[model samples]
Target: GTDMGTARALRRNLEAGADSFPQDVVELMGYFQPAGDGQRIRAVPGEGEQVPIWILGSSLYGAQLAAMLGLPYAFASHFAPAELDHALEIYRSRFQPSKQLDKPYVMLGLNVFAAPSDAEARLLFTSLQQAFVNLRTGRPGRLPPPVEGYERDLDPMAKTMLGRALSCAVVGAPETVGQGIEAFVQRTGADELMVTAQIFDHAARVRSFEILADVHKSLSEAA
Candidate 1:
């Protein structure tokens, strides 16, 4: 559904006979550069009954627009870290209140993989890191088994960026990860946190989620 024309047509058809249907338009989250043809995107926000617009990005462009339009901003920090600081700074400085929010609201996406211990979490993270490396080298492939030497193999710059981005991620034992998440939320003041985990193994991914959920529960209890 990349076609705006098709979206408009669908909206018109859906509204034709519906009197009580929800008319609020939901624009799917997508990376949008502010300098790129933004007028078309601006047209999408007020299409039907002042639809809420969320500018999604891993960098500053999205934050700038979200602030300019007084809209919500969602950062794809889970996968990308470049320009993260610029994005947050721009969003906070330029934010203007709207009916939807009394002040600026920012949501950050994180990659979380919680397990029994740090060693286990590292084992799970091996394949995820490898996948990223493969993508960087243009050898995109399915997640592979966790190997022993990924930490040593990554370039210094890449390793540094990954560490910074994952600063908010939940890893290690449940108790340890719960503490990390609590500190992350406190530091970032993110209203919402979206998580994406990749462990190469589907069942292991599920287990990772389960462990994180339990950590959340533990944190709630502690709170």
Candidate 2:
């Protein structure tokens, strides 16, 4: 959540040589100052790397900054989708061209819990539901094991919060997941998707991703 000027200064430092350090970097003046011999201090490994910078946000602030800076924007829709649509709208509408990019680019976060069966996939998703509720209620701890009927036990407030926060999630078997993913992409028109899963079992987690990958491949082929 760095301010625009500070983020710009950091980017300049990373892309500039010691002699080319920005003189207007007030926030990090001392650390980026010239040496006794006259050469300005530079980010050793960072300098001249030309690393790609993507602005990530769960609110409108990040979208505006990324638009102004012409950087790719990523929305944290997996956990905070309340502002996803509005933020993307702001980013695309207010975007400016810059050396790094010529047009606005967007990547949306999504939670995918896939399994061989719809019932199994829904069961796997219970861990994330429990975890989200626990963290919001200030009882945060290690990821809990999946409970058979976790959603049925959540208080109304917690249920509503989860429903809104995780609105971008897909949970099902391969065919069901494929349909869900296609619908999401078509509705959002996102340039890219960043998928995440929170299954408790290690093997189940791995399998979830594998199923998602297969679904992605099928989608690509059909496209």
Which candidate achieves the best lDDT against the true structure? 2
Model 2, 20-126: lDDT tens per residue?
Answer: 42232322333433323433445555545555677889999889878877889999999999988899889999999977799999999999999999999989999
* Residue pairs in collision within model 1: none
Tell me model 1's lDDT, rounded to 2 decimals: 0.73
What is each predicted model's overall lDDT from 0 to 1? 0.73, 0.84
- lDDT (Cα, tens digit) per residue for candidate 1, span 63-109: 87778767788998777766766788899999988665667888888
Please list the residue runs of candidate 1 whose C-alpha ends up more than 4 Å from where it truly belongs after superposition: 1-51, 153-161, 164-168
Once superposed on the true structure, which residue ranges of model 2 sit more than 4 Å away at CA? 1-39
- Cα RMSD, each candidate: 9.4, 7.4
Residue clash pairs of candidate 2: none
The TM-score leader among the candidates is: 2
Give the TM-scores of the predictions, in the order they appear: 0.73, 0.83
